[model samples]
Target chain A: MSEERIWTAALVVIGDEILSGRTQDRNVAQIALWLNLQGIRLAEVRVVADRTEAIVEAVNALRARNDYLFTTGGIGPTHDDITVDAIAEALGVPVIVHPHARAVLTEYYATRGGLTEARLRMARVPDGAALIENKLSGAPGIRHGNIFIMAGVPHIAAMMLDALSGTLEGGKPLASRTMGCWVAESEVADMLGAAERAFEGVQIGSYPFFRDGRTGANFVIRSTDQTLIDACFAQLAAQLAAAGHDVVDGGI
Target chain B: MSEERIWTAALVVIGDEILSGRTQDRNVAQIALWLNLQGIRLAEVRVVADRTEAIVEAVNALRARNDYLFTTGGIGPTHDDITVDAIAEALGVPVIVHPHARAVLTEYYATRGGLTEARLRMARVPDGAALIENKLSGAPGIRHGNIFIMAGVPHIAAMMLDALSGTLEGGKPLASRTMGCWVAESEVADMLGAAERAFEGVQIGSYPFFRDGRTGANFVIRSTDQTLIDACFAQLAAQLAAAGHDVVDGGI
Candidate 1:
């Protein structure tokens, strides 16, 4: 497992609405799942307000640490939409009106209304950036190096991810198996620790929940290697069974 | 507004389930909303894995910049739960079995199961830490020098918050007013910017949504001063109306 290549990405969610609790962030989960499907692990997530300095700080810090950096929100056609400007500043590049983006917005708004000055704001991108196609809206996503600037809207971000599917280089996706038992996690803490330590690359997570006046826990075993994951699960399940606990196959 | 003190808090969400996309975080919004009600601003949020180094790093970094730091998750009774240890290490203190916490857990688990050694893990706390009562769960939250360590479960965290409500010092709660208009956010971008600038201490946020086969945007004016927020909302709403746009009072 130490010899295997592992690719990681970080996400920065930028919006005052989210920080104010006015909006619930769906982008983190959406992006994490998408990155997982692309065989990349989502390592960390930061939620910052609609501030230029904050955006720049998060972008620079994360991009330097991870293989890829993704940002969501503040990519709209409003004064608050300053993500492009901040990212451009972070990269030491100038903001430019991407021609393809302008063309797309012009055509899309031709039927609704002529592309007004405010609407044209959507075309702005960091210099020397490639466009990620957006099937839901006219504003295309910006891609420069390993940094991807995406829309704040959940569906729009999903579309951008769809455009990016299978386009990035990554290692094998993580595989996981969940087993549930109606026992306190603490009861099996020793077994869980020993199994995890025995497996080379496996990491086990225990989630406890109280339902219908009963306490239960779900143990999830994850690893890049499917065989290792399976072996770890088998060992854990056997140990739990030996301790008089019934293992639910697919989790409760 | 500039003369008024601004109380800010940051949150560190600790879990592997969240980073794995297996869990959607509810703590950020819940804590943000609760902080707002307490006249404190939620400045930033970071979601990190269940690693001691990551927890320590996030805790040290955010605790220095903000007035208060709240951490959720990684406090359960399992091997994966190591928040107390990590925080204790970060604070350069040894983990001690808090007498109050031990008594509470002992009594709570007396009927279900005797407080075993593994269950007693929940009683460990950083030295010199005070307990924040958890009404839902017997294991209380940890409070040490402006750092509040809460449960991962949303309801239990809410209970902990309820116990500590109004106990912390804070400035005036921010006031906000929302207005909805049946127009693209880009169409009113300039007007929104101007209205925000015209009113002192007011910041406006524009959120666009597509509904009923039409695009609309909601403008929210926020400020510590209610009068200023109202003024900003009135000016922005009038401007939208003057432009032949329908304005909804309470937002779309």
Candidate 2:
């Protein structure tokens, strides 16, 4: 068997509103799904307040460990939007006005209203960075080194991820299949453990739910190898069937 | 002016489903709102996979730094539910079956089915830990030192928090007021910054939205002192009105 290399990415959600619970975060799920499509695993996520020190610390720590780092929020046109400055400090670089970003903002704002100084703040980027296309808005996302500074807005962040799709190098995507059963998780704990141990590369996650006065669980098996995933699923399903429980394919 | 102490808590979301984008996390927002009502600030959130080493590291780090640490997920009756063991390792203690938990499970499961060994696993807790009431289910939450181990289910976790309400000591709750305006955040960046600076202890967060083909934003001002929060809101509202923008009382 050949060794498989796993590409991992960490997300830093930079916003006070998120930590304060004023805003429900959708970026983590959105970005995680996007990275999975790119064959990159979203390893960890850190949600920090909109403080320069906090952002810098999380960026430095996550970037050092993961292959790529994606940050959402705090990249807006207000005083509270200080993600660029924090990232620049972490990278030991200076913040500068990117000419392309300036041009984009200037042209886009010309029809609406002239770009004021506050609006021009959206054009600032780290000293050495590339612009990620933002088809929805004029202010493009910033890509400095392996760190992608994305908008906090869920829809705009989705657009940024769509623009950068298939650009990163990654290995085979992880494949997953879910099987649901009406048996309580405790009733099949040993069976699930035995299946996981028997499978060489499959990881199973059991999620229990209480619905309609009945308890059920969905067992998700994940593996990079398709044959291994299929084998693991078949074995687990057979075990459940032998135990006199009906296994639901594709989850309940 | 007297010195004000801030009580802080950090949350560790331990689940592979959340990292895999299979589950949208509701614990962060729910716990943050609950902590705010309890007069404790939700300082940071770290989402990690259902790995023992990852859970141990995050639990130790966050619990050491913050006044309290809350962990959600991986407390179920499956092989993947190793949160209790990992936390015990982090605390340098052995996992032991709590008699009270065992009795609770035995009695609760007697009517439905006998508590088997797998079901009894829920009774295990770190050494010298206390049980938090789980009114919904038989398996109680484990409270070891300052660390709180909660269920992965959203509604169950909410019930656990309700059980813990007003139990922890905290200082004054943070007060906040939001003022909305139909102007772009960039248009009032200076005004918002000035207001935050003018108030001795106020934090202003600008959340912008695009609706009806127009740009708008809501400025949320927060402070421990009600008077300071009120002052900051008034100043910010006056500035927005002076700039020829109508200020919405609650939000746009």
Tens-digit lDDT track for model 2 on A1-252?
Answer: 123889999999998899888999999999998999998999999999988999999999999999999999988888899999999999999999999999999998898778999889999999999999998878899999899999999988999999999999887788899999998898999999999999988999999988997889999999998899899999899989998998999999
DockQ of all candidate complexes: 0.82, 0.88
Worst 10 residues of 2 chain A by lDDT: A1-10
> By DockQ thresholds, what CAPRI class is model 1?
high
Task: Please give the distance, in angstroms, between residue B179's alpha carbon in candidate 1 and its true position after superposition.
Answer: 1.5
Error of 1 at A23 (Å): 0.8
Candidate 2 ranges beyond 4 A from true positions: A1-3, B1-3
Q: What residue pairs are clashing in model 2?
A: none
